[model samples]
Target: MTPPPLAADTHPPTELARVEFTALTGERVERIAPISQGWGHLSWTVRTTSGRYLIKTGIRRPQQADLYRQVAAQQIAAGSGVATPIVVAVGTPDGPLQRPCYVQTWIEGADAASVLPRLGPQENDRYASALGRQVAAVHRIPGPRFAEDCAATTTYPTWQAACLSRIGRLAASIEEKAVLPPAVLYAVADRLKTLTDQLGNGIVPRLTHRDLYLPNTLITGEPAGAALLDWEAAAFYDPVWDFVKLGMWVFEPHPALRAPFMAGYTEFEPLPDGFHERLTLYQGIEYLAAFPYFGSAWPDERMLASFRTLLSGWMDAHGLVGARP
Candidate 1:
């Protein structure tokens, strides 16, 4: 989805004072700059006497438990040797800050999305390989049941059921919002049903970084590797979903990086059987589901037309054709 336009780097005086006092904890607040890229949250890069930190305040206050769960997931990934931000403090609505917020030690680096495209071929390959290795490390951590670990209300005994439930929710949202044409939705729904049927049983769930795209990864010189950011979407899911995301958001658009990333990933864990087919199915599902998010942000007819073109490409790749009901 195209990112929303950045809001000005201004904060209400009262909120700023409260956040500074609460998060800084007696340290002097040097600077507070708005992070304009991400969706659904207001983030600031805060500089203080102690160190630089990231202050993330929800655009709408999230459930307090959900905020805490995100912190827990970040801690778990960091513990597993993944380079994730350390949660510093959390603020609640009852606190001085009205909105739910968390502060974390900010890792200094350029966003991989910008850095990777500008690098020499060798360096680009190196960075992609590093990212793949880091991702694999995160997946190795054992966790509670998929739903319970993430504090999701629903639970499913099988991966297929959970996936279908998620897709169904996305489809419902798209339909209710009138995000895409009925023909496109019908084709995607049909393909997803067939794909679900083809999924094998006994799939084991692992901790997945559900949104592992280039923008969420940081490239640093000190550590000389890729660090993952934004653990809010972390959950217990089929490991294939992570690979699917990597392919869709990174490798598919930048094919040169693919071989190195796969090399690093397979070095740690070998690809399972029928990986390509499963990845393709997931790509289609992900693109279709993403319409609700993108449509809500960019509601223009041109954006809708772009969505249709992308969906058509996905359907064609999967040998599915749209038919109006």
Candidate 2:
């Protein structure tokens, strides 16, 4: 059986705000469902008098609105043929009216997470391969504009230095949360050395989405086409880095989706020589460095668990810790 569309009322906002926003957009904000309110912003969907649209507003951490990230996202989205919300409004230093808020067309569909559970073994593999191919397409985007992270993504001049800098950032955030196992902190640092020892010299760099999680990819009506959204992390880097992030959640590489996705990837880029080995290293480095991005303020249990699990995977690849064999 098919799953029902995500109920529109997932996160309804206040009635008064709805009236005001309606006047603001010049379209009746019939239903304003709050989506997620993160660090400095809140997102709500407006079933307007005319059509459906998404409205994201900046709150406490309002400065994020003016960042160059949207510019990067706009460029990438244009090249990738993906769906993205255009910047509708941005705030000034004054207040809410001046704060950054975006409104764009609301796509009616489900994310990969919702559809994954319903797929058959073969279907899952097919979708994975499709995802892999799409990722390849995203990597091939041409531009020298994102040179800053490009070199870093290709190969580390000094992996140890890079690793330390990364861990220092994450550790700051980890410390803010509940007591983290001292071993986990130490283990995160120690594993970096092990991965660095095996690091290869040169790597290919390309424009990478940086964060292409399942939920970020949208599947549209009946014939279901894939569309990647959320470009806040867009930058030039090893395209493989995108795949590493997408695949990390799979414990053993999902029983259904692993092979086809890899095969599909090879068709486009011929998978980097020693792709598996390098990808493993990239995954570990990326996982540890990302801890703070997600766990900085929120001491969420799940976030910490994911942090450990990612580390464990890293250890498995390098024998960084005492033998698990």
Which numbered prediction scores highest in lDDT against the true structure?
A: 1
Model 1: pairs clashing at backbone N, Cα or C within 3 Å: none
Off by more than 4 A, model 1 = 1-31, 60-66, 222-224, 297-306
Candidate 1: residue 183 lDDT (0-100): 76
By summed lDDT, the worst window of 10 consecutive residues in model 2 runs over: 1-10
Off by over 4 Å in 2: 1-33, 36-41, 47-51, 58-62, 65-67, 83-98, 120-126, 142-168, 171-201, 221-224, 250-253, 290-296, 321-325
Write model 2 residue lDDT over 1-325, tens digit each, in one string.
1112222233324564465455456776667777763333456777866788776554433343333354455445554664444544433334233434456567676667778788787667667776666666677775453343432232333433444455565666556652455566567656665665665655544667777767676655433245566665666555666767667653254645667767766778677676777677567767665555555543456776776677776677655654321
Give the alpha carbon lDDT tens digit for every residue of 92-189 in model 1.
65655555678888887889998777899988888888888888888787656655345554567877787788778878888898877777787788
**Residue 32 error, candidate 2, Å:** 4.9
Model 2 residue 285 distance off true place after TM-score fit, in angstroms: 2.2
